[model samples]
Target: MNTRLLFFLLIICPLSAVCQTFTSSNLPILVIDTRGGTILDDPKIVADLRIIDNGPGKRNNLTDKASFTSVMGIEYRGATSQQFFPKKPYGIELRDSTGINSVAKSVLGMPAESDWVLNATYNDKTLIRETLTYDFYRKMSKYYASRFRYCELVLNGEYRGIYIVMERLKRDKNRVPITSIKKTDITGDAVTGGYILKIDKTVGSTSRSWKSPYPSGPRNINLDIQIDRPKPEDLAEEQFQYIKKYVSDFEASLAGSDFRDPTKGFRAFVDEQSFIDYLILTEVCKNVDGYRLSAYFYKERDSKGGKITMGPIWDYNLTYGNADYCEGNSYMGWAFNFSRVCPKDDFVLPFWWDRLLLDLDFARKVKEKYKALRQTVLTPERLGAFVDSTSSALTESRQRNFVKWPVIGTYVWPNGFVGRTYEAETDYLKTWIGQRLTWMDINIESFGVLTALREEAAFTLGPNPSIGDVTLKLPLPTPTDVSLSLTDMQGRALQTRHWPAQPKGLFERTLPATDFNTGPGVYILTISTQTGPTSRVIVRE
Candidate 1:
């Protein structure tokens, strides 16, 4: 359970999400979590953890970013300020109950905890001091280091500059794929089993100790950043469906034992939105287990006709929270967000521009989706009660008074249940919703390219294995020399035809496939010309 909790906590942490640091260096708890089920006395871990191990004698364990992965992949390294971190560590345990303690002390230049929240310079300092409050945790063993952040995502929804990337573990190096067979048939079920076995994948050592805020030296954590390239927008659509399933499973898991629905965690607090709010949230924010995992389709070239569909699910880590990380993506933090993919002031794609241009569409349609889903997934009663309880729990989690979070003072919960959320804090944030709505006015446009030539090269293919000829709908830009090569999935060229590229318009071609021994399988059609290249897939019986 500790291992699973640790893994999930690491996946959800947002502060150091930018580093994608899955290093075993700073998180010494992972070191002590020898048994798979040990619960953490978290306060102890935060106070003692250090990024550098620096053997007892040399005490300088550092790693740098210059040695950052040559290729963009998931690997963790230790560095500070974009440089590898090589420093000695503080040893032995002290009885200091104050959160201001650490082994990376010298690294942080021993500044008072007051001077260091996000920025602290410690060159002559002896060690780096770390801090934590009880509100950060969900259970005594787990914390929201993955979700909550001191950084405000939206200063009134005007894009407060934040970007969050969730780091979920994918297949292990020795993982095997189960491509046994395919079932084209379909019988609709409320819950169609996912083709991908996500939750079942085992968790093991593929990450380091402190996989947060990189600069993890001597920590063999792979920091993978190059997300799968974008496929056709349709591909993105398919991924949306896949994640819709994942969310269902996660919600069901909440019903599992040992889980707390957001509302009943610690104390009673009102959720600003109704059951409708939760529903709309789950609908638009289709968070799949693999939303953070980089899968094969991210780069697979097997597009039969549609583009690959997945996601950059960039604003994650704040799972089940209201703070944005780097890219002010307040899209779902209990408030309306204009656009995270594209700021209104910047030139963006037409589709997202559709969201920016018509904020009302997102607000209304999303509101409707929320309303419908709320009826089914989260009942109004369930949410109404939860709002009061969780809000109370949030108010109670405040303890061990830190100046930064003065809201923190002597607080206790009933039988381990803590109230969360400062009522005033929630209200302060809500008032900005209007300003955020106004901030979506960023200019959305791009520079047009005037190349040496111009024409619309759109085409369509159909009626494979026809007794007659195949008609290909083509929109050519100019009448130039064009060659068409037909092939199979194995790249075996089947036929070639030569023709002239027609003017920027649609044309048709009828070809006979009577010579090829094509059965019920996949085939490819490639049209090449001086303008560019286009390919399509064909299925024959």
Candidate 2:
């Protein structure tokens, strides 16, 4: 065959394959040009980039004065991802003519940002896991979930399949809203807060990390956490010590006997709502690395919440029935229990969640939030529609993507295969999600309620931070002897009442302020049943 015919057969002829399902690409085309055709593993290397809209009919066309930028990195997980495949991810940094970092003009109507990621969908056949996961978090009102736009990529004049141009997670007014740390402001309130830390495996420049004090799994191993902001060199000694000490104190309180204390326990150092929301998202998807890796938490200024928040979820390509290992593809079990199943894994989840699950209050809150979310965000109809719309958007571009890198009918690393073709892959995702949501819906409602301790126990306390009188209520699951104990912050019982063989009904009692010490502080209220002990925090004002 002639060389020209070979070139046409391989590149120019879009429909060379007789079984072509789509003839036209309906997503924007991104063209990247490297000076020496060298995009390295390092994020700093720069290559030029251009945008050409290829969607149906036409959209905003690039102008003559359209600003462009530099690109770097071919693999997303740095060098680790390169070992698996030839095609890799890339990073784009918008720059002005003077080579200074600047925001690029919005492309395909995406928000303007200085940095963006062109993720390679090599591992994920559906090519929508990350985007869909982010969509779920954003809909659930997660703080600063990265927004993304889908587009086709051509690097060094070669087609490189479908890619998503997503906002990079960082501290900025438009991103993670938090106080910016400066080396100059080393003392006092300036250095006390605002830090982003990640629980992940050690890699690259992020080697400057600390190990957890508590051993997590059966191996008695501690996980490593990396500081994302305030580069180690730029961080002051006091700032470093302050953050370390704060986390250490929080961990100490959480592991202590009085871990349920509202004033000095883990609740005081972490945001409750944020934790619940994170748990729902992670558990719903059964992310293999949910708490073990790619887990992020941030702390703000003392005046602003003054607590750590788990947020801005990252890396979900291996989630949502995607992974075959560690029971990731299963629709059963809780994501928080991954450590119990895979304890010997190098990176394990902290025991924080395990301990939290033991707390009845936290479990109840999770159930409540999950119940509310199911009606709106996690509903089967709504989730199915979202997946349908995403598949429709990729209908035309998917053919081109498959043509560029044909892995549809093949296995990639850790996939729990359900089908082969693009349509089959997408159908698999939709069906898996629908089934997963159903499993979660049924399980979450009965989550902590069906514990061996009780079948239908109802507990509530009102007028938190009570002034003179406090009310405690308990609706027992079965007829049994129960004991109510009121204690000070130090776990010393102040008042105790015993009820012999109480029936399965609501029990209400009022504690007079005169019986307790006269002052403002925190106290513990415990109701011990034949099954187990239920605890709550009572504040006396």
Candidate 3:
């Protein structure tokens, strides 16, 4: 052994201690010798790691030459799972010779990355929930989802059962694919682009975070928002303020009266398609923590689709009928409505989802997108095939894992249902997915209907990105008096017009540019009728 290896062993374990060795099977085997040091929640410890994989159709033995070897730093990962589960997930950092500096290396055909995660899948007896969820997101969404590989882990002298080596979520060309923020890029367009934020619990490590200015949906709770990228320490004051304000502005517009406006509403700041996809994924799986926690959204630079986009989905072990609480196991309801289902839960979903559904256009798009996805990636047959393939791959490894942990027939905390066998667990998952898809297909049309009644009375603004004058095409059901008023973002009225005894047909009126001193900004035009008041957003360029 080298001097450093010898020193590590001496400091971490007894001199006479003999580490256990194992022969692997069909799957890639990862052997980690931590000397004898315990992996903690924070501050990783140095370790020696080796991987034995002889490629496809080949079996690896402990005595075989290692395909890859590295000096590494390993630590316990996950929140509740780390605290309660004996089979714990781990965070890994590939280290250089000194065992201090991180070095990126590709493992098991995955892209090179210094940071990676070994998910223990303690709660998921089938051991495919996280992998399946990530795969589904990757197939359906344009955004990058974490890539994962299944492997059996041996820590010190003990076998750690089946664990997935997955790419950690971060700013990388193959990961989040957002412009990296730098200290110098703290002004103008440079500062505006590329930010990653998450709404999650603030119980762990200290990181720079802010609270939502608006309360969570009917829960009256302000969500704790954390800056995921640009590392909290590296984030400049200007960068922090810029992202913070941008989110706040999005919330403000989403909550405004004319929030449905395509140009001035929440649509102006967010990618509607991403939000739609996210909603579909969450609802399809009934993820207990969806939206409220582990939810990620990123904004690229203005030149590159500047709108804030949701995804690169993370932390999905508690999804797809996996959890017992908050109607998580049910395939009948929308996951975004968790606040209403579990009002007393400490974490509440952000108001953005409910408000977004309130917009007719957004709801229509969501329905259409879900309908389209069902024909492709979200189909029952395709999903079932993926589950079966993954189950087959892990058939041998799972027996070994269950022998080590013995959680197969028993209930893990928060598990909605416990199966007597691994096959049963997977069957339940498939059944749940089928039911969920059917429920969504039958009920998703309601989203389009929920806001249509209110929108029917609203007028449509034409030449929306109007250069000068704009036309309003109003469909009146009956002759009545109508009052029109335009207001700025701050709710300050800019212009007012009245039409008395308007015909029941479509009424078209052109508002002259000179009527209001317009430059470049967002204006809300409200039309008050006897039935109710309706509003539309107008953009002045």
Worst 10 residues of 1 by lDDT: 124-133
Which pairs clash inside model 2? 74-89
Quote the RMSD, in angstroms, for model 2: 11.9
Error of 3 at 449 (Å): 3.2
- lDDT string for model 2 (241-261, tens) is 778887778878888877877
| TM-score attained by model 3 | 0.80
How many clashes show up in model 1?
90
> Which lDDT tens digits does candidate 1 get at residues 11-44?
2123322322222221111121111222122212
RMSD of each: 22.4, 11.9, 12.5
Report model 1's TM-score to 2 decimal places: 0.24
TM-score of each: 0.24, 0.77, 0.80
Cα displacement (angstroms), candidate 1, residue 518, comes to 59
**Alpha-carbon lDDT of model 3:** 0.80
Candidate 1 wrong stretches, greater than 4 Å = 1-307, 310-369, 378-397, 401-421, 426-541
| lDDT sort, best first | 3, 2, 1
Pairwise TM-score winner, candidates 2 and 3: 3
Best by lDDT: 3
How far residue 316's Cα lies from its native spot in candidate 3, in Å, is 1.3
The most accurate candidate by TM-score is 3
Where does candidate 3 clash, by residue pair?
193-301
